[model samples]
Target chain A: MRTEKIETDVLIIGGGTAGCYAALTLASEAGGKRILIAEKANIRRSGCLAAGVNALNAYIIKGRTPQDYVEYAKKDAENIVREDLLLTMSEGLNRVTARLEELGLVILKNENGEYAARGNRNIKINGENIKPLLADAVRKCDNVQILNHVNMTDLLLADGRVCGAVGFHVDDSTVYEIHAGAVLCATGGAAGLYRPNNPGFSRHKMWYPPFNTGAGYAMGIQAGAEMTTFEMRFIALRCKDTIAPTGTIAQGVGAKQVNVFGQNYEKNYGITTSQRVYGTVEENRAGRGPCYLHTEGITGEQDKELLKAYLNMAPSQTLKWIEEEKNPSQKDVEIEGTEPYIVGGHTASGYWIDRERRTTLPGLYAAGDVAGGCPQKYVTGALVEGELAAKAIQKDLKESGADQGRYFAGQTAGNQAAAAIRGIYSHHLKKEPGPYSIDQVEEAMQKVMDQYAGGIGSGYRYNEKQLDLADEKITLLQKLAMDLKAEDMDDLLHIYEIKERLIVCRSLIAHLKARKETRWHSFGEHSDYPGKNKKYEKFVNSVLKDGRIQIIYRTLQKGDIEI
Target chain B: MSIRINKEKCVACGKCREVCPGNLIKIGVDKKAQIRHPKECWGCTSCVKECSVNAIEFFLGADIGGAGSWMLTKEEGDIRHWIIHKSDGSVKTIQINKKNSNQY
Candidate 1:
């Protein structure tokens, strides 16, 4: 059979924030050299920052010193953050921003025209358009070529190390292989493992890009890369079953969190509102559920008031409130308290790497939201990590004599990865009538996540029973994934991505199970945790081996780390 | 005055909440519109007519966008539309209501 094969110096997957940044940075380093980006979608629309991101988690803009910011983060995650990681992050912020600025991307600037502060210490970012613009930069570079509308099915392993990937073109089911010196997996995060549509179904159900099914994460795990922080999902307390930020109202309005008892919840919990991270989580655990941040308690009111600076800025929460309180669904769901808006913190999952973006696996590197650093899930963090990984690759390439690595094969891969994808493409193309189509499997997955498994209303209370149910449904999805057929190009991408979601979902379940005490989120209600675990102040990270999950906690022997 | 929503057409994009004169309007489980801060809502159809899903029902009186977010004295029929002012100078907000209820 006629097959397609391509080769490059660097092969990056997923066209979202990390992939785009990796492409751009690689181009800068390998000027006139070749690079390929295998994006399931075109350059302008990547999964990472598709709907815009929440904020720049790592950009310490004006007032906050990297050292001070690091100290604050350490205390917030209950003093479990790795000190070295925090320092690397703090130090790397400016150079990353300057790189973007040099790329024609404009970050909000200060009065002196330097990169402006989103918070006192962080840069105010425009999440909505940053990914596309980054894609544009990648496109403009002559050194990089984006193989769009292609779904990556497997990694090309040279002696158990990632050398490249074999993917199929979504349009006509054409198979292609890319052999590279280094393969950077930036396939964004896995979403679409489940969807939430309680009684008041979403007026819009497409909360996430349908394609971010965690292809990269699956590839890494399958490749034997160690995954971390899989359980500490970047969960959001979604409002009215829809994905909206209560943080917008809480952190924005400085609304004091009063429990149903109307007591001073924050004070009752011994929390000082100045600490933004833990304070909210603790309040929720104390039955403060959904509450307005009181101006008297915290300066969070600035978040709301500051939004007025935007053009015609209106609060997104009001509509969410109307639906939750007024919708006609039989199941009465209120998102005020323990509900979380769970989105994959892609970069949040990888092994604890240094500023150089090195994964524990030599020659394996991670960037974007898929790479882990405490606050590494934002657009800026992903951007910075991507550049750093590329620079590391540059150094490695210079030191090594591995010219045997990275080749462009005009013929597509003929192995398991390529064959696994070919079956799906043919199934969809042939329009096979089966037990489930790709969409059906996806819908099934979403229902399971939203209804039972600590989705919204999960005051950290995912009973072992419900977790089993989620697990059963997850197995069904995996079963369906194997037999499922596709209907179109999008369906083909969706099906394969669903497999990726299963990996993320399985990891998250294990993570949830491992954490005996709910730190940020309460157990079931997601609204309440009785008391602090005082569990050793340590980091909770996860890794996969031989298809099994492992959990680790890193804390100072004292349960709090020494600065 | 309360602006009720036509639940059938609403898509729960939450665009109304972003523009609500009052800090009201939220997305419920079904992804439909919900009233959050009823006291906060100005009873302005900014949400009612502003709703692209057409989920919002206009109340008797709410300063439709462009009418009073700024001192806008346009044609009553033109008032059906929303206009936003940009100080650094840009035109934002699209007035969806082409027919003027004020004239009627």
Candidate 2:
């Protein structure tokens, strides 16, 4: 394989929502600075917005204040949040929404010329091409370079600071050693960790992007970056087989959650996000299942609206309706909870970053879903975090007087990292096929997580004994993963993806065992503890030291708590 | 559900290959796009929208309530049509304007 070295002032990984926006912000604020975005897939249609979205889910409406949004998210997450991060992110929500509008996003406006509000904290938008718009803007910047089809494997560190990263092109034998003054990781969150609702050929049919295999989280964990709240997983309550979002019906048409007997049960448990999924699971366990969003008897106009709204984000649901020759007015939409995912956007489970978005490692900053402490940070919130991270990187680069020249001086460390990655890739290429294939090992890992680590098969519940088994089985899979072989660049990518998932699984199980309380119901249902404890209100943080997950607990940061 | 690419409709534009999130679609020696890993395909239909010639068709498998229907996309100026061919010799089309997508 050929090796290529790249030097930049700032390197942004995973050119999705946050990475593209961060590139735009950095290019606009600091011209002539070299900025590079390394994306595993093309930026035009990647990450969670590949198919697009129906609305800017996180926005400050006309009546609601930023503090009000923070309070809402804090309440939804049951007070285990970084209020400072949420407040900072909340304050910039509207600004980024307006920026998106200026950049050619179609935000719906009401008769008063105000942006249409979906709920208290969301604005309606035709966001099918949101990623393309952001990508187009970034492409126009002369100082930015986009490296598409490059899968980042690991971070490059000098001493204790993150100097750059190393990755390989997905379609070729070219390895890239990217060195930068500061690195901003926006790789999004992890999916496919647990066995999804659909199996076999439809395995990718889940809530989050199946391609986002928690590379950032795995790399950070390997580098010993502090991570928080991995136990607070995000389980989306979606339409039954299609796995399309239910929010379009619930919020757009005001549909209520009802059981098989058409009994409203959303309030029976709670209305919080986690509580919504928890109630669904509980109802199903109590044999009142086959839950649904009561969409029957809706007007034809509303049915048309729901169909078009789904086309903007998930067209499968719309297609399912069309194929069945049925509309929401005719039947209620069946809904179920997806396998749990570790995402910081909907639920906080990612890097433990400070207010400025700096991780524990120097020169390393995380934003978007990869950055923890902020839940419900949807499209607009990711954009805000990108902007926040860009501003912070610019300030840090200026204050530290670290330029491309000084960054290039760390080529020795970069060479060592590049060599280590090249060796790993070479080993994979040269190794003979072992007893387990990539799919076999991946399926085993998923089965272990599904049965023993609170996956949907277990109704999202687990005890200390189950977690211990999960830990043991996952460790064995990691060892088997080393003996796996790669046939081509495609196989190499799959191998790394599975490996990254295993690493995240290891850390997730550790966090699950550490958090003994059943604080968030189905999200973190520690059946051994069975009850929430005031003593366990602190954040459960972990850092990998000496090849072991070192658990650390820190008190909550309640910033400007006027609620 | 996976995708099937019709070589006759493919113009070898390479757009489908670039947009596939899984990188499952590749242009073969005949300069026609093909899905290398059909089983691994997530049926996201990103390639369908990017294909200007409607070369890629997503299978609506029976698992997800579809009775072996196939879906394709056709773009006409600012309007995009999602056409589905049902197994029972029926066709259904949904037209969406790119600009007025949020008119609701």
Candidate 3:
């Protein structure tokens, strides 16, 4: 089809929480400059917050300072979090959330007329339209152009610097070649790498956004950017049947997790939010589970607020509760351990970033779930990083001497780039049919991951033998990716999605194999190495070097650890 | 669990299809929301929320809900009431607020 070329000063991929906020920052700071956001879905309803969220998980309230917040996150991640990034993000968390409120988000208030505290650092908010709110705020900016329903396939590079990115529209199938002075990868995090809890007829049902298939991580890997913490995946303990956020019962109504014997089990493990999932899984393994979030003691007002929290995010949970004729306030709500997912939002699995949110690649930056090292970022921290990245981009533009926005003179550069990208994707248009369809390949990859790479089937437990099998199967899947064929653009999108996932999968396996210790606990349990090892506390960084995956170990610097 | 849409109550507004992130919901020839690929559905329940006529519901599946369970949403101005029918013949109701509706 049609070929369209777009030129901008900044290109933001994936208009989710980070991208939208980045667009807002760029528009407000660098007025009259062209900013483009290329999103696979409609920006107003995309990414993890598409259905909205219940609370600002990273907000620093009055009693807590930024350093205190960072310390809490560092402790939760078992001292593996990037203190520098967390400190910077925490410093801006409250301001960003307040700005969101000023931009129309309704933050719940206490009787004292202050932001109400839900837990230690989180604040309650009626964020039912958080995405739409951010979308509207970005829409008010004149220079920002949002290209909805465009799937970005690859990043464009020249002279060891990122120049732009290329993609195709989901509905129109028009090839889009975008050239930008600076590119921000905010494509959220990965899902579907492992078999979901509800497989078949509901495969897309998972904790994270299903459409966020690790495109950012994959593109970064392909571009030879250093990525970290692929081994420390994010596993959530959610509502059993609906896979809803347990925060509604836990923090919203202050419900504690209880086993089938009606014993409060989380306290036994000295659990943090991330460790709670592990605790729940271990309880189930000990035959104490079929665990439930105990909410029988909450008052009626708290129950109402708890329902409000669910309405903001995962309203289906409330719907399920209503359908099941079970009031959480009247009875304990069942909770289940979701399958492990590759996410930077909860865990620290994404691109390694500097203090300015700049990736290793020149002219490219990353934030939010795509930027690694910062865990428990949630929505507010992502917004803070987005603002940080945007501010950095604006400052860099002013100090640079190179001609900016002039390279996109006409369609030639973009067309040439588009043609080259199309060449890579041309295998999908090949006449020779491959042996496997997209679904078959996906299923095979999932099965391999589930059985070997610490998926739900393995109770998220992996050993050297399983990792070896995962390695072998993933290698075959990568080979199969090259011979894939598609009948149309939709199929082509799936092909690329699988290809990207395969790239991430290989990286995941490599990282999983490198880390011997079971550091991630329930998220990634290695049977061969059953306990946490201080030696492996450093980050497991991986990069695609000369078309091969290479692993590196980076010890956290003194400053990174101590802030 | 997959989303269930009541064809009899549907008015073919297409809001559910529009908000469905996976694009799994389609308007059949009968002008009602139909799931094209039930297996691929993300189960985000965006369709259920966007369906103002209460024509949509979410089934938690036999594995999770253990059969005989149902979920529905009732909107009252700035509040949403969720009513659940549990497998054990119990009922629960929860209310949530919807503030500043016109902002988005």
Candidate 4:
């Protein structure tokens, strides 16, 4: 195995939405500088949009301003969200979305030739090829380089600043040491952390990409960056069995949630989305039985279009409908709550970044699902964050004369870090097979999180005792993770992913324990302190120091943007 | 839902394993399509659309899907045709137009 040493101006981990857009932005503006994207999978069909998306969930359409979008986001997050990040994302949403449209994306239009609006801030689109299109656009840039199948294991930090990253090629098992002037981490969010609804072989049946095991969050935590809002995990209410997003039915086709009694129970309770999920759990716990997403009043055309939307995001739901001999035009589809996920795209949980998407750690910028403080940012907002991060990196480079030589600060420190990381991987290969397999360690972590943390087993609920157990068990699991051994390259990738997940798990437990009040309801339930307290209406930020996580609170201030 | 590969029909091209979003499939040592982890399957059917030999089959389990129902996928250029066979012997075909591959 040969080790490849590459030098570039900017290094991006994860060639998903944010990394691709960042590469595109820097290539166009950075004066012929090299931009490299290290991805775990092929960029043309990777990340959450690998199958494509049906609607632009964060578009600021006609009659709806960016301020309205920000206000709605604040409401969605229970009145405690980063107003600055939301305002910044909201202001650039339409511009970035329109740019995508010009780049060969087909935004659906109504008979009047206007953009088809789903809700107040969403527009319909035929985005089945969004990822491929973005990948193609990024490839067209001469300065951008994408290295697929390289799994980023850790950030290369020297003197508290990220100078590069270390990863290994999955196919050839060769180490890659990439040194850059700046590094952007946009590796999406953690999935498969809590026990998924369909465990075992069906574990990939999840709302988020199962492969994104919190690499971005873990790397940031290990680098001692401040992370916020891990307590406000995202628990999506999806279609039963398939775990498909219910937005296609609820918002796409104007369907409503009905009970097993064939009545509009959610409407009867006057509930919102989170309340609806809680109501369903309560109904089932009270022996009312299954709930359904009733599409009885939707027209045939609407139902057909709804299925098309499902085809874009999660086609399995449409196939399951056909296999079950059920059609939305006739009968309703069952709806259920999925396992909780720690994500920043839907919830406000990730690296604590300021206005420029810059983390507390110098030379390290966060974007996409890894950048905290904004919620409901979906695809377009990630693109905006990527663009902002790129501009900030470029401005910093220009100010420093572009050739100030960042990696020269600490050659000894860099070599020590690189050697330590290489030794960790080499030890796994040289040792006799360890007692615990990677899967067993992953299973132990997930079981502890699901049973004690705010997973579905406790009806998305948690008590103080359960949280304490989660903290203790997660710590033990973190120790156990070191003993995980691998026999092949694929196993090595899993070992790295599982290790990152445990690092993220520790932060999640610390934040959950710190937040005494139940703020986000089903998303972050605290049964011991069930009521929402105004005093606890702040962000829970944590930073690891001296082998212990120091948790703190940050006040959510109103931004000058008025959004 | 789970995907089943026709071992006899499979040419071991590994296109199905390459296109699967969940990374659930792999080529066995015997050079045949193997569903390594059936439970982790996200049922995207990218494998179904990419397999030129049309050797892959998908069906939902009895717990959710009834008996005698099946699904087959075929691609003609940019258009994918989903042939769904219902439990009642009736079949429905859905044509999904994909973005042109030549564009990129």
Query: What C-alpha RMSD separates each model from the true structure?
Result: 10.6, 1.9, 3.5, 3.1
What is each candidate's fraction of native interface contacts (fnat)? 0.00, 0.43, 0.34, 0.27
Model 1 agreement with the true structure over A1-563: per-residue lDDT tens digits: 23686767777877777778778877877745677888775666446444344345566755667888667665545454555655665677777777766664535555686754443454544443455567778888988887876778777665566667777776565777677777777766655554443222221222344345577777776666666555555444333333344333443334445544455455644432122324445556666654433334323333223232111112232222222222212222233432232232322345556557666555567776566544533556566667777888777766774434435443233245555645555765675667766656766776677665675434335656677788778877787787766655545555676777776777667665665555543322322333347773455666677667677676543222321
Every candidate's DockQ is 0.04, 0.60, 0.32, 0.32
Give the per-residue Cα lDDT of candidate 4 at A45.
76
| lDDT tens per residue, model 4, A1-563 | 56888888889999999889998889988887889999887787778887677778898888888999999999888876888899999999998888898888888777798878877777877777788789899989998888988888888877777888888876567988888888999999999889887775456767888888899999889889999999888888888877888876888667778788887778554355577787787778877769888887667777676666676667777877666555787888788888888888888899998888989888889999998889989999999999999988998877877545655455567667877888888877666777888878988998998899978887888888988899899889877777777676667788888889989988998998899998776888888899899988888899999999999887878863221
iRMS (Å) per candidate:
15.7, 1.7, 4.8, 5.5
Report, for all candidates in order, the number of backbone clashes: 88, 0, 15, 4
Name the lDDT value of residue A487 in candidate 4. Answer: 74
- Location of the lowest summed lDDT over 10 successive residues in candidate 4 chain A: A402-411
lDDT (tens digit, per residue) of candidate 3 on B1-104: 67778989999998887667765677888888898667666666667777889888766656555366666677788777766667787876666667732111
TM-score: the better of candidates 2 and 3? 2
Clash pairs detected, candidate 2: none
The TM-score of candidate 3 is 0.92
Cα deviation at B58, candidate 3, in Å, is 4.4
Candidate 4 lands at a TM-score of 0.94
Residue-by-residue lDDT tens digits, candidate 3, A1-563: 67787778889998989999999988887857789999887777778887777678888888779999878878887777788888898899988988998888888787799988876887877777788889888888888998877889788877777888999976556888888888999998888899888876556667888788899999899889999988888888888756888875776556788999999988787677657888888888998979998888767766565555666677667655565555777888989888888888888889998888989998889999999999989999999999999998888777773325564654365456668887766657765887888888999989999988988888888898888889888999988877878877767778888888888889998898888998768776889999899998888899899988888888875454311
Tell me the spans in candidate 4 whose CA falls farther than 4 Å from its real position. Answer: A267-272, A297-300, A403-410, A560-563, B7-35, B61-72, B85-91, B98-104
TM-score-wise, the better of 1 and 3 is 3
TM-score, candidate 1, is: 0.70
